[model samples]
Target chain A: MKLYALNMIQPVGEKPPPEALDKVMAELAEVRRDLESQEAWVFGRPLHGPEASTVVRLRDDEVIATDGPWTEGKEFIGGIIIIEVEDLDAALQVAARYTRVTGLPMEVRPFQGLI
Target chain B: MSVLVRVFGDVDVAEEAVQDAFAEAVRRWPADGAPPSPAGWIITTARNKAIDRLRREAAREGKQAQAVLVNVAEPVEEGVVRDERLRLMFTCCHPALALQARVALTLRLLGGLTTAEIARAFLVPEATMAQRLVRAKGKIRDAGIPYRVPEEADLPGRLTGVLAVIYLVFNQGYGGRDELAAEAIRLGRVLAELMADEPEVLGLLALMLLIESRKGARMRDGELILLADQDRALWDRGLVDEGQALVRRCLRRNRPGPYQIQAAINAVHGDAARAEETDWRQILQLYDQLMGVAPSPVAALNRAVAVAEVEGVEEALAVVDGLDLGHYYLFHAIRADLLRRLGRREAAAAAYDEAIGRTENEAELAFLRRRRVSVCG
Candidate 1:
């Protein structure tokens, strides 16, 4: 088995309808619970909006600080889930299902080195 | 390698253990006599080696995945050892890797050639080949590419990649080295046996055999001899018979593919007892079928040659002129011949000059230069 990071990407200002959001949230909760019970879920968490993000860099031994995500991309990483799976096909299926439940586009990338 | 990789689920560890097992075999086999099943012995030893290595690593990392190796007690079957080779072939031909990387990895993993040897064969630096292997291996591991042969639905697409790699190996040897050609024939035999029902596999085997059958007369005195000028008696009749037989078998399947069509075309050439006896009309039809199924400029170029034989030089010249293969040396060489046959001496000489400029092989350059001399003179 290998661990994959499924990063949820969401538009910065777009929000679903109140009822749609509620239903999606409920489905997300159920799916997460099922994954946790199956021991496939390793860790997961939602993130604050990109406005609250901070960037820190070191240049020529001088500290520099900035606000916002790394780039000015319209969509930002809203949340992420880590799961242990057998192969790329399994990881892709999990990512697709997660997107269907949460209404968020997901990017799945495998972690290097075995657990 | 495939069995060990599946068991360990890690390319690096599987490779190391297989190497170690081979080393142990070299040390122990002479004294104890060869085992009844050498492959079975190696797999068992490699599996034990992997388990031991994982056990030691688990003590340090304490990971759950590493701990799972403690329960690895699957029986090693001889059938699995055979199937695993097919699995390895599929993995090497995975579409995710670049074509060059796929070919290099296949040569290294399945063909059992060292990186330096592969580099030499492909005319690249050893370091570049080494890096390509490392990168391809890393990608396979990080992407979690499964080490299993594709399902029935994906076989056609995946098999194309495998066949291309095999033919590339054959061509690499066809350039000069007999050893590489012989190895490719052996691999082709294995593929033909394993994929007995595939018409294209049979086609590829037949094509390789037909072309390689002329190895003895393909060259003389370090110079490439044109097919028309080569001594017919030097051709290997045994190989020609076998190749023609395979082509006949492919025709019976009634499922024509590019490779099968090409093999059928070569079979037509093999049927000729002398150069003047060649049935160009039959060859031209096969090329037309080949162009329909696998249309490429190279195939078109070859079709033009056959057209010249069946049709006149003017007709063939018209067909060749329509093709977009200005950079191909054979295109220029063939054009030169067509121009010469049409009595356009200066144009033929110019085309031969272009052919000599575009080619890399010393023998080919020599042949082209000789053609240029005759055309200019």
Candidate 2:
């Protein structure tokens, strides 16, 4: 068995239009329901946008805090879902379904170590 | 090895126990002569060692798997050892591990090869190979990958992966690493003996034997000898006989597969009394059948070469020109040979340059350069 993380990433500082968001939410609910029935879905939740992110660094004797993300002009994880499956193919199928409903790129990575 | 793994319920611990049992044998076998049942002795000793190790760990952690350990430590039956090794092969070649890892694990555990030897064969740092083996073993342990042979329905897919690893080991050995070739032969022989009913297994053993027989004459001094230029007397006739016998056995089964077809081709090559006596028409027919089943570009390339030998250069050249193997070094090399035979010197020289550019093998590059000079100069 394997656990894969499907990270839904989108460009920073961007949001879907309200009507598109509604459509996606509806589709996602149905997807989540199907995944739940299959016992494939473990957990999923939307993430806070990049504006609320913070960065911290330890310099010499002081800890410095910054207001923005560590990097800019890039796609950031907008939400994430975890799925347990037998192999990569099963994980890929789940990712493809999520991509169809969410209209965002989903990066599927296997969770290392026992899960 | 698989029996030990199942008994211990952990690959690392089982391997360590087996190693300890071998060490014990080394120390005791010389003085005590030998045991009546050597394999049974080793299995019993390894089981005891594993139980001791488990007891030590359990005592430290206050765990109670000691009862289970005691239960599994009973001497395994002799009849199960062969089946256990088959399961071990399936686990070692499990698809979850990386391809290189599969090859490394198969060589290490099944072939009894040292990590250093495997690293040298692959030209990787010893540390990297060690880490790869560790990671693969860890995956097998943590991912709950069952250490057992696949069922009849799953055997085809699973067995193919095992055969591929064995063949890869053989090819690596064929590329000037003599020990790897020997190791592959040993592993192949084991597979043949254990799976005697499986035609492909016999076919693979025959293929390795036929190819390995020619290795003695493949090189003269330090120079590579083309097949036609090799001294036929130097070939290992015993291996050739054995390989031909295996080919006949596979043919009698009437279950033709790629490996069986390949073994038959080599048998044809090995059967020739002299280079000129090679039955190119029969080879071409076998290659046609091979292309039908396997359908790889390399098979098509080999078939074209066979065509050149049996038919005319023009017919073969037309076949080669239709192939989309421009990036492959052997494709260019064969093209150069065909063009040179057709008296297209300038085109042949160009093809040799492409072949040289694509190849990194020092010996092969030297051969190509010599061919280029003979053609263009």
TM-score of chain A of each: 0.92, 0.88
Model 1 agreement with the true structure over B64-145: per-residue lDDT tens digits: 5665854466667888887888888888888768999988888888887888999998889999999999999988888887
- DockQ for each of the predicted structures, in order? 0.61, 0.10
TM-score, each model?
0.82, 0.80
Note the B-chain TM-score for every model.
0.95, 0.96
Candidate 1: the clashing residue pairs are: none
* Candidate 2 chain B lowest-lDDT run of ten: B65-74
Show the lowest summed lDDT stretch of 10 residues, model 1 chain B: B64-73
Q: lDDT per prediction?
A: 0.87, 0.88
Candidate 2 DockQ, CA atoms: 0.10
Best by DockQ: 1
